[model samples]
Target: MKKEFSGRVHFVGIGGIGMSALAQHLVHCGYAVSGSDRQVNEQTEKLQKIGVKVHYGHSEQNVKGACLVVRTSAVTPDNCEVAFAQKNNIPVLLREQLLGEIFDAFKQRIAVCGTHGKTTVTAMIHHVLERCGVSHTAFIGGEYNKSNYFFGENIVVAEACEYNRSFLNLHPTICLCLNVEYDHPDCYKNFADVQKAFSALFSQSEKVILPSELQKMCDKAVLFGKNGSVQAKNVHVGRGTTFSLYSDGVFACKCRLKVCGRHNVHNALAVFAVAKLLQLPLLQVSQALAIFCGVDRRWTLHPECKFNVVCDYAHHPTEIAEAVQTALSMCKGRVFCVFQPHTYSRTKAFWQQFVTCFDGAQEVIYLPIFAAREKPQKGVSSFRLAQLARQTGLNAKYFSTFGKTAQHLSKTVKANDTILLIGAGDVNNLTKFL
Candidate 1:
């Protein structure tokens, strides 16, 4: 397909995973790409290596001579580059708007959307499609193995995040909604608001893949779950989940995965449904899923030390509860959780749920909230969360710094104990020290 946009494209906050993936795809599609980020990171460096001019700091000068400026949701209206683009009459697009334009170029575009597991499910679908020799492109949410964006032909598989109703911007041929819960308190008022946004996205999709649990949400959807159109039966959960997939009440194939958790089984089920819908060989799809190691931070285990460390990008209450439960299920020893709340709004919004999410952990270490795109709220803090957890009969402790947290863990964590670093923030940085 011909590239949609011509001339130079500048991305504001290009260091973000989603923004960088779009920039990478645009560069691959033959657009002259230049971007500026607040700080240089691996993503920015990768962009520079791939010939995208990456400026270290945001400035009006960064967007000079650019035909279009793409700004991430985190980028504010007063951001220098965004303001300059508007003032100078350069076309400005939101991150999702550009993604929607890119989606238009593909005939078999699959968008995986959910409050959780979007990254894993999108990456899984991409892997299966690639293994089946289906030419495809994917814009993954997390850095899976090495690259987040894979350039190919025909099909495009991408993670559709629901935050700020961004996924609604995409009109995919195939859409998968793993599950939904109330999240992104800043953008969504409640669960009903979240469901309304997803309902809009589902309505626009040509074919929707959803869980049987959410069958009531969409009437004409290809559902996957215990009682869905595509079902996983005889499931066995261990170091990873192994199950048999049945398509339309008929036995299809048995599959195994290296990625742990029952949640992952549902994620793989969505991928299987996509494969079946696309008419890919079931055996090949199962093979690809079995060998799939997982995205970068989704139950990523480091086994070099006495106590193994598992890192995950699970920040929401449901995700946190699942991560802790999954770690408990796989580990033979005690499961310790080092959790860093992602944002102040989320922490404040889900405070009660967050307190109960750490039920399965043997000991919980609470790190300060990351506060990515929001300023800290007056009464919302990790210390308060820890206090709540302690009140609920949890062995919880709060540490102000990662170094002190690591020190405490080193002293307390015994051999064979599994430390699960859980969050979407820099809590993963503590893994290196451990």
Candidate 2:
């Protein structure tokens, strides 16, 4: 093992969900950890509770005592802390590289990858395995209610993000490519460029599982959406989606979800296929999924609100559609869809696609792009998205703030209507008010 930077590690962007989880894991593993982010967030506060010194912003002082300084993909040499690390000759590693090292320690590391539904699938898999008495650790992208079981263990399960080629560093024992799609136009040049990275990872894996749609993308992968391995046939969605798993033949099947969505059924099946491949009992997997409450800020409810309200971390075209359609399918009345585009580049690049994703909403509301790591492009705004949706024959509108969006929804949404606030961004915070 490389022992040059074993004493202390400082994180450059610790407020992010992935960054915070990694920080926690390192602290739990007996590493001296500290970090810096743009602002103080709940995640940073949590890290502080665990005795991690979190600096409010990046600076040379933050990395003072660090033998190693880790930076997120968004961090560049221009970042004060990162530059300081270089000037001081501190061993610097990308976030993925640090995760790769930790993941390498485990024998059964499972990585779930795709353009969308990765979070749900990761949570489903984690839930099933935990219920089946498997001692495993998970680094999910979102917050999950399985608090007692959501933790680190002998087996490391994590959501492998494709942004800036982060997931490529992971060494997975059972790597799951959920489904492939074009995204991250900011980082990757185009769809082919993104696919190239996935192809390389799947090519190197011992057992690669993927949706059948990606077969042409990676020849060696074990396809799942339709053909080679696990297939969910006769899919039905109501109360929850239930479908039979067919490999050589069909198996008697049913699934129940507190969450409603067609995509989630597919997610559950992905979990089933993986667990069964690992020799986990199908019955145990089903029980776990049925009992699993959906992840936090992912279709969560507000306490005082009589109308149905859900908070989801969905921003991509595919993700937005799933959230809206799921809310519509489960509700008795109209569905109000509120969206916050995640980044300027993504909103600009996938503009047309986002317009068509909200197929089932009775009304649509948009918030300014979250701008995860990019400055705003002048022409890219939620109003543009609203206009795009309007062209698609949907009732669309835009708001600059969460308070305004909530106010509009309060007046517009009826008693029986279900409101879905969707985005990977801070749009979910709107739920605190209404």
Candidates' C-alpha lDDT:
0.88, 0.80
In angstroms, the error of model 1 at 105 is: 2.0
- Poorest 10 consecutive residues by lDDT, candidate 2: 144-153
* Top candidate when judged by lDDT against the true structure: 1
Candidate 2: residue 429 lDDT (0-100): 74
Q: What TM-score, over all chains together, does every model reach? A: 0.97, 0.93
Give the per-residue lDDT of model 2 (tens digit) for 235-258.
778766666666545664565666
What lDDT score is found at residue 188 in candidate 2? 92
Could you tell me the lDDT of residue 304 within candidate 2? Answer: 63
Where does model 1 exceed 4 Å of error? 1-4, 304-306
TM-score of 2: 0.93
- Residue 2 alpha-carbon offset, candidate 1, angstroms: 9.1
